[model samples]
Structure formats: C-alpha cells, structure tokens
Target: MTSLFAQEIRLSKRHEDIVSQRLMLLQQMENKLGDQNKEKTPQMQRAETALQRNLSLLKDIEAAEKSLQTQNHPVPPPEVASLETLYWASVEEYIPKWEQFLLGRAPYPIGVENPNEAEATIQKEVRQ
Candidate 1:
C-alpha cells in the first residue's frame, strides 16, 4: 500500500488494467455462450460470476477515490486525478450496471462529429 496520492495513481492504473481484462473476458465469454457446438459448463458459469464480482469491486474503488479527492484539502496529484478521471469515464460508458452484462452491445468510446456544434463555433473569418 502507499500514500493516498500514490494509491490513487496505482488504483487508477489498476482500474484501467481491469477494464481491459474485463472486456476481454466479456468477449471470450460471449463467444463461448454463442457457440452451439459446445455445452455451457459449470466452469464457464463460475468465470462469469468472478468477472462480475471483480468489475463491481473496481467500480467501488473508483467511487472511494472520488470521495477522497473531494474530502482532502490538496487535490490528490493533479495528473493522476485527471488521468484517472478520464480512464474511469472512458470505461464507464461501456461497463454495464451490476448483473447487466449485455454483451450484444459494446459501448466502445470513440470520437464522433457533431456538425451542428461545429457550425455554431465562430471561426476567425466569421468573427471579423
């Protein structure tokens, strides 16, 4: 264990790593579940349960980190906090609510165009 600040960074990293693991797990499980050639074994069910539990734990850890940031005087390392927030948020859109693993739809985060908003922005030429 480390200081709160250090832990923040560590947990942030952990969260990211877990997200990747979980997503990969989800995909793997999805394939297993879909394959009609094989029967669903008890081991497969156990693995699914384990993944959900781990995801829940990670979500709890993130919530605790946010609370620490709010309560503490100093902002807990700025770079760590900012990056953690970004990583957590980026994954948030994908991870399903507890017991709600809808593998059919993966909310992969990506950049998208908002033409209306882009048009609203005043360019230098328009300003002049």
Candidate 2:
C-alpha cells in the first residue's frame, strides 16, 4: 500500500510538470504575437497615408483637366475644321428628316459661333 502511494505521488508530480511546461510555451507565443503586432502597425499606417496622398493627387489632376477644358479650345487645329464639316454634314442629313418625317431643303451655310462652342453646339443640334 505504501509503494502504491509513492507511485501515485510521482504520477501527480509528472502531470503538474507537463502542465507548467505547456503554460510557459503558451506565454512565449503570446509575447511573440504582441511583438509582431507592434512592428506591423506603423507600416500599415504609413501605407494608408501614402494611399490617401495618391488619391488626393489624382483628384487634383482631374480638377485641372476640367478647368483646362472649360478655359480654351479642347480640340487641335487640324481636327477642328474636319470635325465641324462632318458634324454639319450629319446634321444636314439627319435632323430635319427624322423629326418632321419629310425631306426638307438644307439650311444654307450652317455657321459655328466660335471654335470653342462649335463642337458642343453641333452635337446638340444633331440630336434634334
């Protein structure tokens, strides 16, 4: 009976040592995770900041393009007169017949107000 008691005590000690070793390993893993998180957070913040800056720059470029478009002629010289001629020709062909359903005489000399206004005006008139 005494020998049996000694065996039970030794088994209990072994179990306790195993549990302590497992706890130590778990604590070490938790510490490593904490360190990794600390290292990663600053890098993530810097990336976020860079992304925001790039987005802001893109918006500025778009705004600049819009401003430039409204300020002066959007089309180059060689394309301008050709585009105008094509536009007026299409208008002469399409608009009056589509709306009134009868072949009407073409308007004489469809003149543009100015180079800047010509493309937009022609597009609007053609849709009619």
Candidate 3:
C-alpha cells in the first residue's frame, strides 16, 4: 500500500474506534437508566439527550460509509481484510472489560483473556 493509502486506512480505523467508544458509552448509560423506578435527575436527562444525539450521529456515519462504499472507495485486499477482521474481533472482545472499567464496575480495564492467548485462539479459528 502507498503511504497515502496506509494513512487513509489508519484514519478510517480511528474513526471506527471513536464510533465504538460512543456506542459503548451510550450502552452504559442505558443500562444505568434501565430501572424504571428511578427518578430522572439532571444528569440522567442530559444523558438521555446525549443518547438521542449519538444515535442520530451514528446513523449519519453509517449512511456516509455506505455512500462512500457505493461511490467506489477502494476495498482492501484479502490479506489486509482478513487481518483487519481479526484485529476488530480482538477489539470487540476487549471492549467489554474497558466498558466495565469506565462504568466503575471494574478497578482496571485489562481484558480477561491474555493477549497472546487471544491471538492464538484467533489464529486457530482462521486455520479452521
């Protein structure tokens, strides 16, 4: 890949990471507010407003990505695609522990599975 292509890929992945973080935050807020008996405080009201805004933003991002793809954006080659898929799968697995830390449900954000172990598992899955 050219340097410019590499940079574009990095930027795209970063955008995806930011979107995932926003979704996680929204999920955390929703879980906290799941209790119907709880009164809506100012903070809760703010969270609700933010949730709506985030949902709208997420929809817009998805639509923009679809438009770009339809407009002939370059697709990554198979090798890059496979590696990216594995990278994202690992990220998805780690996100829950990070979310728990952010929500104060955990003291630290380390994933339950060892990184090496996770890599091995992913490689095994790929081989199969």
Identify the leading candidate in terms of lDDT. 3
How many residue-pair clashes does candidate 3 contain? 0
Per-residue lDDT tens digits for candidate 1, residues 44-123, read 88889999999999999999998898888665787677667665764574355321435545343232245554344323
Residue-wise C-alpha lDDT for candidate 3, range 1-128, written one tens digit per residue: 69999999999999999999999999988987775436566679889999999999999999999998878868778988888887788778778878878898878754334778666777775764
What TM-score should be assigned to candidate 1?
Answer: 0.27
Worst 10 residues of 2 by lDDT: 101-110
Candidates' lDDT values, in order? Answer: 0.67, 0.78, 0.81
Per-residue lDDT of model 2, residues 1-128, tens digit only: 99999999999999999999999999999999999999899999999999999999999999999999877866667667777777778777656545444434443334443566667766675555
Between which residue pairs do clashes occur in model 2? none
Winner of 2 and 3 under TM-score: 2
TM-score of each prediction: 0.27, 0.49, 0.31
Ranking by TM-score: 2, 3, 1
Global lDDT for candidate 1? 0.67
Q: Against the true structure, what is every candidate's RMSD?
A: 37.5, 10.6, 38.6
How close to the true structure is residue 59 of candidate 1, measured as C-alpha lDDT?
100
